[model samples]
Target: MALAKGTRLGPYEILSFIGAGGMGDVYRAWDTRLERDVAIKVLAERLACEPRSLARFRTEAKSIAALSHPNILSIYDAELEHPPLFLVTELLEGVTLRQQIGRSAIPWRRAVQIGSEVADGLATAHDARIIHRDLKPENIFVTARGAIKILDFGLARFKPAFQGKPGSRATTVSEGGSLMGTVGYLAPEQARGETVTAATDIFSLGCVLYEMVSGHRAFNLASPASTLAAILNDDPRPVADYVADVPEELDRWIGHCLRKDEKARPQSARDLGLVLRDLLAEPTAHGRTGAEFESLAVLPFFTSASSPDAEYLADGITETLINQFAQLQHLRVIARSTVFRHKGKDADPIELGRELAVSAVLTGRIFQRGDVLVIAAELINVRDGLHLWGQQYKRPLTDIFAIEEDISREISERLRVRFAPREQSRLVKRYTESPKAYQLYLKGRFLWNKRAIESMRQALRYFEQAVEEDASYARAYAGLADCTSMLAIYGALDPRLGGKRARAAQEMALQIDPDLSEAYASRGFSLLLFDWKFREAESVLRHAVHLNSGDAPAHQWLGFALGLTGQLEEARGAMRIAQQLDPFSASINTTAVFPVYWAHLFEEAIEGFRAAVELHPGYWMAHYYMGLTYAHKGEFGQAILALRHAAEIGDSIWRYSGLGYVYAQAGRPQQARSVLKKLDELGRHQYVPLIYSAAVYAGLGETDQAVEWLRRAAEQRDWMIAWLHVDPIWDSIRSDPRLQGIRVDLGPKP
Candidate 1:
């Protein structure tokens, strides 16, 4: 009854069975003649004997083979044979939407986008008079590129094949089945055994969208009869009730799709797709926006200073002014890391505008002699390379804060950007007046943005030096908090000491200036990583965003906080905004590593790290995350390669433990044990390493030894404990009483 390895069907050599269901068995097969991989679906011999079932199978094959859309699965060939009748379709690598929904609900925008594509595919099929009677979550697949495709047209009905006239005959029902579609997703008319139409497919797609947004099916019933009764008599729960963050306008659109009466629903799939696209096109409405120009890019200032230190200071000034205005929602300032790339180059303003995708670019020149500071700035329209506004500031050396505020206000007013009253007050509050301290703080931030352990340490040195020079420099304190928090996360500093210093720095910053949003984001990240106080971290991160809507780091930190709290949908949205603000940022991409690691989605994390490494090959943290992702996915050889690469870049002690797990998994127990010994010799055999050793033992099938190490990891409060419940690598030991005890000891899920 089952297709075994080496089984030959038609022109394909079946490699192995992939999966099976009531309809047929799917196999990973080799197309010997074509020399390529293909999925072969073979109908059961019993089903093939039934004339009606055989006709439906052939009709499905023919229907899909004729109608081709990018979002619809392609049917390659069909064969009618003596033993097994088979249909071959394109093989896809990624999981289905059904699997995705099991982990977390898709964001409203992404859900709408996927829904729109599915509708487009179905509308194409419907135009050709083909109706997919069964449309469910399992039938919709998401590709590696994040595109959607509809699969399994096994039950599709073709009107042209059944009738001779165009829209002249009423639709007919097949006699083989009573209930035509999946129970929970069945349309009302379809459940009542009425003629199937395009409206039926539209209703079913609406159910899929509802499931994607709410993480639940539209209907709940035990049997087909019960499901039919509910479909006829009951109203589906409003989507807003389940996902409160979804816009009300989106809820209204979905509500229309799920209407019980056929006429009340969308007239066609094409019409429904347009509505969904419109929903996704709406700008995010959940947060506050600044009153002034919401987005701006600060170009490198023109400077002819002979001293490199002065050149650095001039660049720092440009950065400082950009950071100052970044807080206002009305002004969206491009991150310094992205704009600074064009420094010292003759870049056309219009070309820079097109590349940076900003409406305006601000360029400036600075000249400082003795205690006198002179600066000139101009805002240029990127589209036309014309000056929008210009200003000149002459200030005493001690009044640098006044200079920064004056420049920021001029830019804001020239752009006519609106600011909230509270935001205006915060933007006006000067953190310090010392030019020397401000220069040091800016240099520290610039190095910190490099996101490497050595750079972060150097940045911390400068920040601490700035604070020592002037204790009341609030921005310097904020920079210190950021560096310390990052050091703890990267395992470059002791969590206890780093967290204490980070908190102290943040407290001092806020004490001196409560309007410092970067300090809040920094402190929030520290709380999330060290204290594991998720609620407090989320509160602080939200406050950071509210205080400074244009702060990319604040939104980035907020994304991490939400992800830590298992609010993945909102986390994804926040992450999107961060990416938009810093599109070329290595640091922003690396941030995904921690959240994905904590979430135990090692495969996704591995792909993300690979992308990050490609973007910045010198980034050791990306290599480290890649090693972890490989270790989780059971690719020990690749894991070792990545971990070794990380160690080669910088001897990070964290990779030693990960390498131990990879060694054990690859069946090199001696190497694994030796790595553990080396870790002990280095005095880095902490809880994380112990957990890795436990996983290595488990991989070696040493249950008792694995349990012993797991116990140690739990007692030490190892971070990996958070993923114990869902990590697939531990599936072998999950049933053990010792592992269950360890899970309970680690406290409830975060």
Candidate 2:
């Protein structure tokens, strides 16, 4: 019987009922003294009065109270002196393993992970000579963070019970002659009602592993008696029958656990844990761990005999395949921005892989006929430049959806990745049935990736058409949000108006598909740039990474959020991960240089930004950042040259501002004032960031004029104001009275 809400047992006050089970009723209770939520497991009133049941409850507490492990539930306190006889434990926030299994069959890799953690927990208890007789899905909990916890140690028996005498330190309880464990998970020895040891727990864990991987009970039958009899007499069905393509090694391992003879079963839980770890870390043919070899890059496909309109078609196919690979949890796909850097460049596979830090490269060619598409794709091993897999497909243009699915499946097979059914479905999930809408969405993405104001505005139009073509296009809405935020950040649109549009588009994207990782990323960037909601940005960006760890922009944005909070080390770590995922991306590379520069590593920043400039010689931002680094080091000549190149490559207010600031610092006030005049004249006709004018004034030591412009910049919501606290460029004005309270006016650190 569940305790009613507000029921009080000792210092624990029941807030709500959590669940009820055969052993006890669990309630969500608040520990008054500690002011923390706890789970109270209360035995039934009838069981509380039975002498045997009371002894068992006390024994269970004493056994668990002596053990301490992260994966094992802790007994906080026991109220046995009172009639209800309740035990309190930490309140866990997650679904039970039984509920998880009910949702979908667990992937084999995930099953191994869950089982390995559970085995480690069991080994800890076994070290103290305790054996869990009831290890089943209902008793295993999977936390939101993927951590596994073993529950219901109350049904456990001390290992010394097998020797006919309990250990001196072990608490003794009656081993009733009735069935004590779930029939589906019973060990052969438990079925025979014989003395059980640590081996009994091993057997039960095997049953759990089989069910987790195969989604079927190992010994399920028409009745409980038949299930118990099958456990002692019949073997579980072959795992391959339930799960195709299970690794041969895993099959053998699970079989060893299910051996009816106790002597043939795995000897110890510790040894089993070691075996599972080895299986997970096994090296592939490339002589690296399976995970290391899973790195991949999909290069832009070469278009053959294609018209201008068909150019987007070829690139769209490659982009679609790259996106499909992203859904594979086992594969680390390089971001499209990085891979596209190699477009139209003749780079060797090995060289590209070394530069990108990936083990494989996917390259292909696409040719379009009137209503047909011919695609030839190959996966090359970067170590030896060997072709691991290659395929050619000629399909109706409308069949591009199925072609994407086929290519994804072949790549997974060649790479030795075994996707669970849910993963397979997600990898090929169709967001839109309209080819026209998908093509429009792809064109919009193509333009959005350019990151220019006009290009983004054009992308917004394409996305609008895409949504009109198919009202349920989630990615198109995400693109809409992305373009809208960039418009606000670049000062092309009013921040207040653009922020509302971006939020609405992102919200619509999530409404269509709640698990869209890209939508979360777009929302995160909008929050960071337009809303200045750093905490919300961090939360959504973290969720984006959790959904797709290979998302380079999410990692980069998360780094920005972390950096704003002064977590410089953590921020650098996240940026490094982004660099790994998108090494050749000019924006990612430029952003990576900032944290190093902010940390006052000017020398490192110069070297890194210089390399980025060399890698993408025409990438204006690299030169812009290199100029800033040189200016900080007082290398006026080099800084002028770099800033001049940035201006010549693309004229922008910030570039001219950098040029003017360098000129003034170099003792050329005439040139600096001339550049400021140019900015002032340009501001009359076009939008010029107020911070640019302020930088020039700051450089010329015009304190009043500088502060005036800075005030206008803050009022206008300039995005560059985010660097006010740490930017060395503002050091000259740091001690000014007007700048004293400005940080409080600006948003929080990040």
Candidate 3:
């Protein structure tokens, strides 16, 4: 029975018929819960109504659902309690491999690539003792972006193994049954009605690979009867006979798969796939193969949307892609902070590549046209300035996931950068299936990067909306946590309130996805600030870096934690890696001076802050730190100027705190009192950080009040309380009993 459009089956609305097959009729459908397109295959009545077939279908479906390989069509849902038994899978867009080959014979190298991908998917299935008894090109799909997906993973088990005549379909009996398979490609034992194993599928794959390059069936004869006889008694003509230029190794590989003795053939699909992939491992004519391709720079993608909102969208895309590429093993992808500084510059790709000292440069343009998002990318070689590979994708906005996956994988393939299987599996790993949630998260990140009071607040709202849309979105939760904690760090919110919210969100994020590296980094920062647990924070931050060495923030946090413990050399090493990973980030460049300033290297720290200000002149973070360093060096004039600039540029509590501290240190006690009066007015409307009062008091030689305020700062979980050991401002009252007690209560920074 054909289900008409709008027909509902278990929350899936049938949109239209996709195709009909012996197993069932496939329909394009919408999954109401996920709000995404899906393909539903309703079993044919013959198989649906048969008790034996129905029982086996459940077993096979359950097994197939457990296999998660990229090359296999994903099974989302399986219903079998009643009639109309069906399975749901991700909808694909492309021709079948049969259609691709029918149009023309593929080159031997291309054929090898296809075969290797197929065996990779099969290897996962075989590991679970679930073989695709019917391994043929007709059951293989070639996605639009050239990905190979194995189709009909377990459908062959839904009925009698076989039934037909010579020159027609084959036949097999019921009871003590095996998975269904085609006769022309069957192994010798399977053809003799004997026990079939994974080796049987290997033999079938040999036949398919043979035809891919030779354009002829491996065992065709005068009749199907003769074909079966040949399978039992003979081997087909050597593949080299059909194509003289075919590699000799491929002929031997096929010969091994067709061995009459089952044990003599390759024992597993995994081994066969590795063998096939190894054939393509030789260096390509135009590009580097291994370490050479590791040095890459993914420049900020340009956008043509002509609006501030679209500008954020473009930057979000570039950053997301950089993060994705950074996880690939052996690839030293340029971090977003560094590459984004070059955005909108009209420099040549090759010139930028040479300046960045990278082997290749990936430049891209994103054009938004209503519902369609056009993304064009080109990878150019630095050594020769040749276009190694390029592609333009004009797809619906919802296809962003597919587009990114294709671009990353294609580049990895083009560059011949090999990754272990586990790493490869994570290359396109998604944090959320909801496109709406993902977009909102991107916007949240874009706004959060602005590092202003209002922008951070606005970013929190977007992140909250994203989590509401998809509660399982760990990355969104991580964003919400980071934003919340930053508000406290900047003194916009009370530390108690902000830390509570941040910890709650961070816990949820980790619970949802434990391996999420950013969430771990966020937790590490909270531990240092709110709990003053430097050792625990350092270990957690190190694990975060271990999870993703490309996560620059992880390295930066590790440096900060190490610096507080007086591990100067180790702290500088971590900061250097962070700088190497994200060299141009004003935040990074400024924070990197923390150890230098703490070690009393005032001149060096001032130079570092100056470098950061030159990179981003308006960045208040650099100016604020610069003022602190100059005051410690007794350069009161320059110190006051930096603090004034910081106050003018930013709208945060730090805007005036540093200035007030400098005034007291310069013996302008009256001006310092006026600044404290201003703070008193501001306190009526917000939670003012106690550190501001402590710093000013310490500078004024009021040791008792300074220590009392320092105690209060520690009690309130102030963001800067950990600086007690490093800030020279605190040294004046180091002998105060209350300050010593506060330091002991804070549990060891040094």
Candidate 4:
């Protein structure tokens, strides 16, 4: 069906021929119904006669229609059942990449940007469980605006385990036994008739990128067979050979992508996109190109407002910007916890930068008047206290997101940071259209960061309100899960019920946005604290860390999981990473005490907790843990004083239990009995971790009573029981035969 100008196909009037391909002919057309220009791709009659070919064509239309991404070509409609079947897509004014790459080399920066955009599109498609098996220059378009758009998913397939390694080499042919994809860009596994995964697309993109930068195909030969052989066995010429100024890092990245073993290639298209963007961001000085160690800290925005709500808004802006910067994998952004330590302190930018070990510091002053917000921010070079970039944004409250985007973009420009397309979108991505919902979400996050029982409850209210305003807000759901689980862990809610709610909220978050690393980390916490599923918790937490290396909480939770499983040394490594990511975070700093305490290094645990106290003397958890470490070392007097101080700061069953245990150990029977009575009374009125009661009894040397409480704790599924293998508090009860049975039941099942 070669449609001449003025031909009508249903509601579309063909105006001119665009081009023809093996599968179809493309015609520029006008969609009368929508009154818009569209490109119509009509399947060739000869190919349409074959059921398998028609099916593949229809699949392409449907696959593309299901996707919504800037880099992906947009599909409007598909006519499958009617004769002269065709697909409608947005009319793009651009040349196919093949034409754009015609016999000339593209600048390295432009090439990287094009490749990064393509990788971002591939990553989106993979997330939708669709694999673009045909990735080549001919299938990509470079719009007049310089944006890259991927075309032709004609060889796309559905693979739910799309992110996993490719299937075995034996399963290459489609159901109809047709070989798919082009030869030149075929991954080595694909060339060998082996199954392909996202890595296949990555390899293809690498070939395309190499051609773009070098003005030659990466693995072309005199014959198709020879080209396939090159793809399967030979390495392409180093990119630097063609482009003298090409960075060694870029060559290494492309080489990794072109590896013969698909398993050895970049496993994630998103990660590859980040690497490409990093290459563009890497500074070149004196003819040297390498990663610039440009770390930055975002100081909490200063506000002179008397209203607490105004202060919250200022804090939220700082945090949101910090989060936005953290998403740029090429940028080293100090965590909010570490940076907020400078809140209200008039610290010099260079000194603060030295404290945070960042190359630069971002400081801002926020003011609100009626419905308007005024923010003045400046980026300062830490080495010399020199201002690098500064801006003042005065906008309506509803335009807060726009302000953030403008700030982020300007900062990235000044810092020489290049973000992948996805990252660029995420830096300004608004999760809710409603400003109220966004505000509530911000407030929830602010409260949640306080990490107190009452604050968590308040955060829960705000999070619920945020979701009520915007049901699709994934971050709000993640916050909901975090608060719900923390309530249970802190004994503010029933363990069983809190765990169930937390899991449900976490599932909702993942369903809305599976890429949210915070949701996965929160789920890992629920798994560990509620279900006591140590192995599954470890798996989820590790995946969270893999997704976002800068996620301090994920690393912290992974360390917690490792500590519970008795992997002391590995736990220490994870904790160290967490501490580096969040140097001043009291919670993260206190995490080190656990592995040291479990390893029975009482002195180290005490020292670690004391150091945490010095960093945050008001952090009750630090004082509480320090008390436990002291008790373990038989310093009962110091333990009692520390525990009492912790109780004064924030009273909890753990504090009472620690106090009781120390008193008992110090031969103060009356005080120990009184503390036990108080715990009993509190248990009747509020939720209490049975572990606390058991600990008190164990400290009193009451074997039968301790075993009884331990049994109850097991029946109730107390989360602390998961640490039975390594908990130093359980050492006294371990020798008791009945306690051994309880320990066995709590241990990982064979």
User: Among all windows of ten consecutive residues in candidate 2, which has the lowest summed lDDT?
Assistant: 166-175
Please tell me which predicted candidate would have the highest lDDT against the true structure.
4
User: What TM-score does structure 2 among the candidates reach?
Assistant: 0.59
Window of ten residues with lowest summed lDDT in model 1? 741-750
Model 2 residue 709 CA deviation in Å: 2.1
Best by TM-score: 3
Clashes of each: 15, 1, 4, 0
Put down candidate 3 lDDT per residue, 636-669, tens digits, no spaces.
9999999999999888876788788889999899
Ranking by lDDT: 4, 3, 2, 1
lDDT of 1 by residue, 1-750 (tens): 887888887679989888886768889998776566789888888898888778767877888887867678878788865658898887777789998888776777678777888888888898898888889989999764344678877688777542234553323345655565688887887776766678778888888888898887788789767877888898888898898889888788777778888778887898888777666545545543212244688888865433344565677778777777787766678887678767887566557877888887787766566677667666655644434445456677667777777877777775667776776766666666666787788789768766777899999999998998899998899899888876765556665677788889999999988867888888777766656666787888889888777778788888876776677767878887887777767777777555666577777788788998998788776787788678777787788898888878864566566667677778898988887777567655432245666776776778898889888766654545544654555777878886666532222333
- Which residue runs of candidate 4 sit more than 4 Å off their true CA positions? 1-285, 288-293, 306-308, 418-421, 735-750
Kindly report which residue pairs in candidate 4 clash with one another: none
Instruction: Rate residue 84 of model 2 by lDDT.
Output: 80
- Point out the higher-scoring one by lDDT: 1 or 2: 2
Candidate 2 vs 3: which has more TM-score: 3
lDDT of 4 at 246: 80
- How does residue 241 of candidate 4 score in lDDT? 88
TM-score of each: 0.54, 0.59, 0.62, 0.61
lDDT of candidate 4 over 618-708, digit per residue (tens): 9888998898888888898889889999989974466787788778878887898998888889889888877787777888898788889
**Residue 722 in candidate 4 has what lDDT?**
74
